[model samples]
Target: MQIISQVFQEISPADFFYRNKEIAGFSNPARAIFSAIRELIENSLDATEPFGILPDIYIRLSSTGETEEEGFYTLRVEDNGSGIPSEYIPLAFCQFLFSSKYKLKQTRGTFGLGGTMTILYGQITTNKPVEVLSSTGDSKIYGYRLMIDIERNQPIILEKKVYENDGQWHGTIVEVNLEGDYSKAKPKVIEYLKQTAIANPYANIMFVDPKGRLYKFERTVSVLPPQPKETLPHPHGVDVETIYRIIRVTKCKTLLDFMQEHFHRVGRQIAKSFLEFAGFPEDTDPKRLKPEEIVKLVQAMKSFNGFLPPDASCLSPLGEEILKAGIMKELEPEFAAVTQRKPSAYSGHPFIVEVGVAYGGKVPVRSDNDITLYRFANKIPLVYDESGDVSWKVIKSIDWRRYNVEPGMPIAIIVHICSTKIPWKTVGKEMIADRPEISREILNGVREVARKLKVYLSRKEKVKREKERLSVFLRYLPKIAEFSAKLAREEKVPDIKNLLRRVRRFGEG
Candidate 1:
């Protein structure tokens, strides 16, 4: 018998993602279409939000064959956003893990993988190059037809051209061909768009589906959410590996300087205390520190009690006023309440939670629970994995009866979590992990909104009871007046209409 040898080889990012498309949320034809659209729209929103421009996004999905259920389809997404620079266009579309979002701030796409993965899926499925056209408020527009070299993880540009522009329009347009099941994906796609409108009432979105149906969600508000500011990482969130990497790249010469400069809430005094606790000299060069010393430093940072929680400047939550307006405008609920919790942190990442509860009117009441929950992370809607998300767990644990919510009640629960780093359970980004801190924030936020909803519902019930009592009293009041007038033998009957009017006014008041 002969012995066999095992062979191992490293693959490029594109190749790895192509082999495992499901990890990027492109599990099937239907999901692929939804994921592609979602990624593109999210990028558009991110670009527009920074400039405080009201987002105007256009999407077109058309099938090449007679029917959308089979064969290939072309998807084009265009946005009025701050377009990508001509030099970075190819890398922006084809390269993986190349992102300006590496800074510590709240953003929709964290890994810089969503948009690239979308194009990769399209390339693998249909063997077609993607078309990209962009103008960054420049005198000319740049266009390119590109494909990703999976083995090399680089962009293969097939065609490039420049067109003279008026320098007025600044936006990007991307078109790709992919094999997808649009008919099946239609519901989720529409739902995602609708929920996006509800969350971002300042955006105007239009879509033309494969069936040539036009769907548009117009902006209801003009104001946009505050942009998140970049922040430093907190000490508790850093690990041994992270510290090693920081030490290697940090500009600070000494360990104390490195600590004070890199980590949030760490000052000169705190850095000195940390160094003393780690048994390292304050002037010791961080680069020359031994591996054991690094471990000790990490441990000391974790155990230090004086370090303040992570800086919350990096988080941008939807304020209560904006959130409530969006919910009211979209859901048309008779009663709506919204709450934005104070900034909090998990490990070293700052986060904020916003919750809204809408009741009655167009808010659908599910048959099983009479409750509908909408979950969002960093303004991007989470359309799938409801049961697995932390928000869902918190929602299920809440006692709805306490809020006067019952079976078949038309109620919708909205939860939004914004953070520098969201705790996602899977690479799909469809579900948030059930971290204790995140769960606690969600619970408190939802409870606050629910309490307000309870008050509204309670007052409504009270008014309803008052109306019923007024109706009964009005009906019997006329009878009593007639009887008294007859007993007194009056020629003209007592006029009860005036009394009824007075009573009605009192009831209304």
Candidate 2:
């Protein structure tokens, strides 16, 4: 019997993602267009917030072909933010998994795949290079037309130009052409921008659609949320692969020094104790550790006690005041309440939860009798996968009746979770995993705001009842007064207006 040989080959990150575009949320033409817009806008927001600047973002979509589904469209997005350095433009747009966001902090894009994947989709569909113009507050602005080398996972620069700047221009502008269904994607894209405005209140976003329809979401405030701080990994969350990578890259000579340097809340004493528990010498070189030693170190870190829960300084949660203001500004609700939960942890990564509830006024009732839950992770809106998210589960478990909310009530619930690392259940980054600690924090936050809503609703009901009672008394008071006047043999009916006024004052008091 003859045996056949098997051939194996390694693939680049770009090639792999190109073959499986669905994982990055570019499964269809309409979704690809929406994803492209989202990625570019999110990148702009991330860039501007770090500088504490109110973002001014502009987006334009124009069709270059006939049919909507089979048409090619050009999308241009420009932002007023801290621009990328000229040297990094190619790698930033053309490469995959090369991101400055790898640090432990609350950021919008987690995997560093969104921006590049968008361009990759455009390239594969329309065979057009992406154009990027940027300036880092320098004397000159740089422009480049580049394409991705999928197999090499690198940028292939086609053209480069430089222009003298007036010192006032600083931001990024990206333009790409892709086959898309703008007609189908128009509503979703607009909704995304609108929700983004509500979540960010400090951003002014303007969009020009394929039909030349201009839409603008103006900023409501000048204040920006606090930027998230970079943090070290927690010992409890580290595994064999993470340990190996840390050991390989660490500059510390000794195992104890490496542990203390790489992990948060692990000081000299904690590191020494951990080494002792792992049966390793404190002064042993971390780079010389064998595989077995690494496994023991990971187990020791996991089982070790006395290390404080991971520091929460890395998270940047929207405060209750800001969240409520945003919800009211967007929904125009008659009553609104917001709560920010204290710091919590899941798998040793610290996180914070915030929730807001808005009722009545412009808030629309759902026809399906489902609560309107606006979910956000790390301040970025989660538009899809509502039923699969942990926040949705928490919402379903809530008894709306307890808050005096009914099936067709005009209410909106907003939830935001900020963490160094969000537990996303899918590669698309559209849904969050149902971690128990995260669920508890979300539930508590929502319940806190719901209690406030209950009070408001109760007061509203009381006022309604008072008005009804006053109406009934007004309807019957004249007849009663006439009868009493006749019985008393008086020629004129008694004036009860004064009595009515006094009664109203007493009731109000």
Candidate 3:
């Protein structure tokens, strides 16, 4: 561990964190497909906004190869989402750690990690470039396609072009050439896209395969997931520097107003309550409060139990309708859809979950493989290897066959959280590790959902099968008709034949 830390310390910040070869190489073709598509998907989501205009995304897969080559492929994703402004084009393609939206819990581009990684990976693997065309509201369209240096982490501009446009329209078009085997990544890509579609059903997605095949996933509904509320800095959440700044700029002469402004979920009444708890008067002027009174306010704040739930309005909720749209769009529409779940608590976390179950759809049957489960933390798709995931263990423990769901046949669930910190193991923000405590917490959370669904489906399937059985019995009547006609021709049992003839005559009558 010491050696590891020493080696880590020796590496430059960029080499150590942003452009690590090992981290970049962890993306196989399957994972790469997901990463590439997710980058574009987030862009699309950002474009379609509070205006409620349903965004249209088109994915075109062209086999850049005329020959029988498997690796030469180009994938294009075009979206009518809010396009990148012409001025920010360079920053959008080149910048990392800007994370302007990082503090935002609801918006999509928290890390600015996903898109930049795609550009980096494509540059490294194919030694090829990527192209991006973006337009702002009523702005001229700017197109940029470039490759970045892995060692230096800078763009090697391959193309800088623009399209004439008016400000009335906005969107982004991105295309990349990758060296990995596109065919093998097809199913995983399809599955990932399908889930993304279900999750964002309000958005329309179109995908084309390298074989010139096309797939389009769109949301039929116009309702979008709610936007995250604007956040105010919480005093407890602030660092020392920020706290000092607030202290310097505070206009209210007392600590009471300071509490209301800096801390989250605490209102003026709550701040007043805290002051009273600390033995200060409710009407005490904030600017005139004594230093001792301020200390009391701080003490009362630490003890207050009724502080409004962490101003979660700043956190976005992935509505049930949108999630299902995301799923049905990418995957086959034959799923048993459950949109949103009531908010549930776990380990002091306040989260809302939306689950979609596809029993037997167009999903493939695997070669004795465990079922493929896609796990997302805070709406970000995680690509960690499945073996280490806690959800996979819970999945394995249950007998999936009982639900008429085979290992490979379109069987999966989705979990979304709205908390400050997800309990995921890595910064990639994918799956939860298989620690017993966390595993138990997640399993328990999903159990109620599973139990209710299982009972509901079991009864539904039983009724369906009973109808099928009756239909099967009805099929024998035709055979019986043929046999009765032969008996009439032979006249083997005169009395029995006579009775059958009478019955046939009655049927005819």
Candidate 4:
């Protein structure tokens, strides 16, 4: 038997993502366009909302190819936020796997490939470089036309120019021409922006579609959500690789100092106790630990439950008021109920769930009798893969009839999960893992709001019945009075005005 030799080659991150575009939601023309718009707008939101600034974002997508709906389109997104500094522009936009979201904080765009993936997609599809204009609220606006060197995974700056800035206008403007099916992508893209508005009511977003149609979501709130603070990783959730990495980089001489400095909620005393429990001396050199020792340390840490619940300060959940305001502004529901669950930990990562239920008015009723669910994670809208999300799983388990909300009713449910580390089921970051703790909190939060909705619905039903009864009396009372007056030989009907007034008030109530 003859054996054939095979070739082995290593691929760059850029090349890998390019070959497997579906991993980043760039599987088709429609999805690619939607993902591109979603990525850039999310970045803009993260830039402003965290710093207590009211965000003003604009997106414009226009068809550039001969066919209006299909083929290449020019996408432009601009934001009024602290712009990317000039020096960091190229790498930040071009390099793959370079991101600040790796920190233990609630931030959007976790993988850091989101923005660059859009650029890479555009470059390969249309063979056009992206145009970027940025200003740090300074006197100069740096403009560039650049593309990624796919093989080397680097930025190729074609042109760079400095322009006069208004000084007060500080933000970023990114434009790219990419192949897309805008006609097919319109609905999902619009829904994404709408959900983004619902999640971040403090941000103003305006969009101009490929057809020149404009949609605006104005800010309903002025105050921003509390910014999420970065925290250290918890020992219980970390793996041997994480511990080994920390050990290699840590400057601490002893295991006690390393533990105290590296992990959260591990004080000096806790560190000493933990080291002892792990069969390591307090003065044991962390750097001297072998691979097997690191594995043992991780196992001990995971089994130890002495650590306090994670600090919730590292999370930024939208309070009940802001979420309610957002729902009211977008859905214009006649009644809205919102609640925020108390902080909870899952796998040692802190998480909070905020739920809002809206009924009647402008809330759209689906023909399929399914609830309209708006899901968000850390203020980023989860538009795709709705059925797979933990929020969806919880929603499916709920019996809406129990809350007096019938199928196909004009109702919308909004759920936001705030966590430093989201348990994403896929690299797409669209669906969340159904962790028991997260699901429980979501269940509780949704039930709380649903109960409020039930109360409103019950009262509404009573008023409806009252009005129906009043209608009958109103139709016959005057006739009855006239007949009675005629039979009694009176010229005027009995004065029933006061009685009618009382009945009218009751009906209204």
Backbone clashes in model 2, listed as residue pairs: none
Please report the candidate that would top lDDT against the real structure: 4
Ten contiguous residues with the weakest lDDT in model 1: 64-73
Q: Could you tell me the C-alpha RMSD of candidate 2 in Å? A: 1.8
Q: Candidate 1, 494: how far from true, in Å?
A: 4.5
Q: Give Cα distance to truth, residue 153, candidate 4, Å.
A: 1.3
Q: Could you give candidate 1's per-residue lDDT for residues 5-94 as a string of tens digits?
A: 889999998888988999999999999999999999999998898778899999999998666557589999999999999889999999
TM-score of each: 0.95, 0.95, 0.72, 0.95
lDDT of 3 by residue, 1-509 (tens): 36554333353323444445335433576566666676767766765753456778888766666652656667687877667776676566665544446563556555665677766666666777788988765647888877665456455666788767865667888888765566676766776676666556677778877666777665677776677666665433344454555566776665567678766766788887766666765555555545665555555555556565454566566766666555554556344455555554333234455555544455434566555566665565554466666676776787665555444454556555454445556545555655454455556545654565577667667767766655554565546666887878854422344544554554434
TM-score of 2: 0.95
Go through the candidates in order and give each one's C-alpha lDDT: 0.88, 0.88, 0.61, 0.90
> 3 or 4, which is superior by lDDT?
4
Q: Model 3: what TM-score?
A: 0.72
User: Over the stretch 287-397, how does candidate 4's per-residue lDDT look in tens digits?
Assistant: 998889988999999888777778888899989889888898988899999999999988878999999999988888888889889899988889899988999999999
Model 3: how far is 327 from its true place, Å?
Answer: 5.5
Worst 10 residues of 2 by lDDT: 500-509
lDDT of 2: 0.88
Clashing pairs in 1: none
lDDT of 2 by residue, 1-509 (tens): 88899899999999999999999999999899999999999899888987887899999999888755557999999998899998899999999998889988888887888999999999999999999999977788999999999999999999999999996699999999998888888777877887787788878899998878899888887888777788888988889999888877889998878888989888898888778877888889988888887888888888888677886788877787668767877788998888888898888789999999889877878889788888888888888779999999999998889889889888888999988889988777789999999999999988998999899998888887877777777899989999999999999999999988876765565
Q: Which segments of candidate 1 are over 4 A away from where they belong?
A: 480-495, 498-506
Per-candidate clashes, comma-separated: 0, 0, 28, 0
